[model samples]
Target: MNIKKYILSFFLLISLSLFSQEVAEKRDAPKPEIKISYLDSIKKTFVRDDLASCVDSLWLKELTDLDLYNNLSQDIQTINFDEQVDYELPTEVLKARLQEMDEKSPFHIEYNPGLENIIKSFLKNRKRAFERLMAISEYYFPLFEEALDKQNVPLEIKYLAVVESALNPKAVSRVGATGLWQFMYQTGKQYGLKIDSYVDERSDPLKASEAAAQYMKNMYAIFGDWDLVLASYNSGPGNVAKAIRRSGGQQNYWNIRKNLPKETQGYVPAFLATMYIYEYHKEHGIKPERAPIKHFATDTVMIKKQISFKQISDLIDIPIAQLQILNPSFKLNIVPSYKDQAHYLRLPQDKMAVFTSNESKIYAYVDREANLREKPFQIVRPIVPQDSINTLQRLAQAKVRYYRVKRGDNLTTIAQKYDVAIEDLKKWNNIKGNKVAYGKNLRINGTDVEQKLSAVAKVEVDKKAVIKDSLGSKMDSFYVVQKGDNLSAIAKKFNISVADLQEWNKLTNNNIQLGASLQIAKNSIKEDVVAAPERKDIQYVVQKGDNLGNIAKKFGVSLDDLKQWNNLTTNSIALGSTLIVAKNEIAIVTNKAPVASFKKKEEYSAPATEYYVKKGDSLYSISKKYPGVTISDLKKWNNIKDEELKPGMKLKING
Candidate 1:
């Protein structure tokens, strides 16, 4: 009997322990809190236009600065929807879910139809954006949380970055607000974010997050409410205060919602919706994509001297794009050389070890390269006496005119057209080579002669002179063709014609070789007797949406010329069809003999199709496989933020 009673007691104890565990589990499980009081109030004050406009403005700002992914919307569309289960939760169910989640947060995560719509919009329409956001969050959220936690601010405040910048650190708003936190220039400066030619700390994730945390803390202190603080963040505290006053001293956000700016009214709802979706996204079947870099994967080191991204990339086998993303504050891809001051460089933690190990070697390489490029070729103007101020002023009474380099423009051609020396053009624009990029503005100091001639006339005269002078001994010169060279460009550079170049080189075609030596001759023209080309009609294809005025403006011809050429009665032209454009009334040409020969094609190799990463694959090494692809391109295409690739990684080699 005693043995049986002891066995019974043991079984009873086991049963009681199991019962207690079941009760604890039930208590811990999240349940819907069906409270409609807050929902009712939000409905009464809901303004659809205000909310939509606010969200639109935020997205517009986000689109303006988003650079990480191209065609983000299209990329999102490409995400497979098979994993997503389509089942709409009732408004009450979502409200309950949010309420259950809200029990753990300081901010009121109330659910209303407006908030519900936003949540659905994100979950359904913007699933891919949300997925990307989630991936990016893995990298940035920790930094934000740490900063906010240190300040004792609500951790949920980190979601503000999503609304502010969509997690892009380099985002700049239409209003000039910049970075993940979207601080205005003045505000960024006020918060100790240095903005110079080399750095805009507003874009630095860690520093900007810290600044945002402090700013939020200050806002919270003033309003004593997180929702109000959010409103203030969106449209300033002064506006929030005025809204409260306009609402007859109501400090509640909903009470003053009508009086707040249209953007602020939506801001609070968007934040609330964002918080809810982020927490409950998994339930909706959204999974975060893999982030390019994980949090804690990167480490920062102080740079004592200035170094460029290319230098770090070439020497340490890091990708320059990775460096740029890691150190976005360094504008111009340059880490400014600081004396007695140190700048911080962030790299992947693994690369940090390599960087430290080869610190001396890296610095030596950078210094050596710098010394080689230290003194660039520059034209030195003759020193004038201080008393010759008037003469200098007349010569320099320069009208600062901006000329955008066209497809066929070189420093030589540009200088000849502007009646300035090539060296002077280079000096004025800080250009190092004969190459001028298309669409880049070149500053032209118009002399007295250039001012008197029409642009078309000047170009024609320069073209004629360059062609006529190709073989003339009076102005003979030698030119070594650089990359991106063509006969037109060479002729422009030497103030000669393409026909003359082909004639002198005894070539039937226009193909020219890099590094080939060419001869140039000056135009021997009686400058006063040069006549401009007569106005003549030229055929032009009317592009889609081309109006007569636009076509006229595009060709630098008058609308009258277009009308006269095409015999059009109206300012309209059919698409994909031709229209005649009469040339300007006159184009000046200098009568001169040709003197230059175009060179034969040298041995040139095409870009490689495939490149395998070797044991020491670096930006410099990889760059050699493809002509024209820079270290920046390697970094950008590979999404390499800090370090170089390991051996055997495939890289796309595109010129």
Candidate 2:
């Protein structure tokens, strides 16, 4: 080697090593010293080993919606490992590999035809899937290892999770076993994993790993044999004991394997096969698929208030699918707060500050639209004043009180109940038509007759208001025209035809105005209006190709509204089961979705500047913040493609 060239090469390697160890400090100033091109070079040269050694695998560059929504269930990536073994491999090669693995492990090392068959089947048929799982294992293995170390279980047991779940945290078996460790509901509870309406801790990575480790520790004490322990984990200890007894008290797994359950007979072999493939993938020329994100990139925070995954995703600009991947325990995409139960979220470490800083704002977004459910999985904002006295409807003499617009509420019915004219109901709330928005507060009895009423008039007004309040609940299936609502849009919302809407309302034209109530159901305007219509529960049976979203759409209700009405904590509804869609068509009206707010405009002297994304900042929002910047420019400058925006992400903005 040339002396001068070799010395320069050595210095370059040292510089890269030093850069990797240094913590990346976020730039708060107007300009960033690290240019995009320079960062790209560092990424290529270092292969991200500088950031953290725990996650140095090649990253899957495209974080598309498909990848975001991909779980073990979708492609049956986990099932391949669970299926019965029926293939053969060269006996010598299989025995040699098994001996090496078994010698390192505390488990029995003997190889049978069963283990060879599984290893052959997995390598032949499930090579691609197993490779991808190995990639995913980069993030989970660290967590499993930590749990195993704490529990004093052998590190080799970490391969058990890979066999059980293919490293998918959200994996659920047909037998109702859940999570990476594949714990049954009863076993999960016994192991201290929480299972409830709002959260299922079995799918939580950190907690589930700990529970699995503890369970493994306990099982080893019972069986005293690793192979038998693996078999017991698949079926149950009782069955394993029965198998041993049937085999005439044989202590060896292979000796008792013939007497075990059909599934359990193959379980231990399958686990050993997984261990073999994971250990020897390099020799087989199987390349692990690139991981989407690393282990160290994520951090957690205990949520202070109840919030939905959609709400957080909207505010932080992360996709809901990614949120589910990070926090699988939230049963309904809702991180609920029940007493002292701790529910939290795991997000990208960079976005941790973004979430913590805007925790109040995110909760406020939910609070403002708590009852104004507009659409499923969409952020809805209700137009409400600060409830200030100045914003209150100013009536001359009549006292003002807000009445929540319920299902079947129309101006005509409200007027009759309040003993006021239809025009008066519209005039008090600054309405353009005779319709009232559901879930919006209406200022009733705002019409003033006299400046100062005598005791007799006041008493009459009081009596009439009392009667109106009593008759508040109506059975009319009415929908109020909201801002930007056209006849066709309104029809779509109610799952009715545009012609049907026009015919029902007896409209001469397709034109509609805000606050104009239109009767939706055919019998909403019956000839004889009864005092209290019997509120029959409208139940919908789960059908094929039905989900909570589409079912909600079929009933013309928001997804959140559907979940709330049924007290459903998750989207997993069973087929052929009846769900309470609505009660008398009473509480299932949709509202308007809100547009996100814009950021403050700051003057920039530099032609190019670095912008750190904040909560609720979208590409469009960023474009608007900078005068000359456009969405196209932002995407091009930052190489953002199919992936959605995430908080605390750095963007290069050009003016």
My TM-score estimates for the predictions, one after another, are 0.48, 0.49
lDDT of each: 0.66, 0.65
Tell me each candidate's RMSD, in Å, in order. 30.4, 25.9
Write model 2 residue lDDT over 174-220, tens digit each, in one string.
Answer: 77888878889999998888887778999998999999888888889
Where model 2 places Cα greater than 4 Å from the true spot, the runs are 1-90, 371-655
Shift in Å, residue 470, candidate 2 = 27
Model 2 root mean square deviation, Cα atoms: 25.9
Candidate 2 clash pair list: 408-476, 435-516, 435-517
Per-residue lDDT of 502 in model 2: 82
Global CA lDDT of candidate 2, please? 0.65
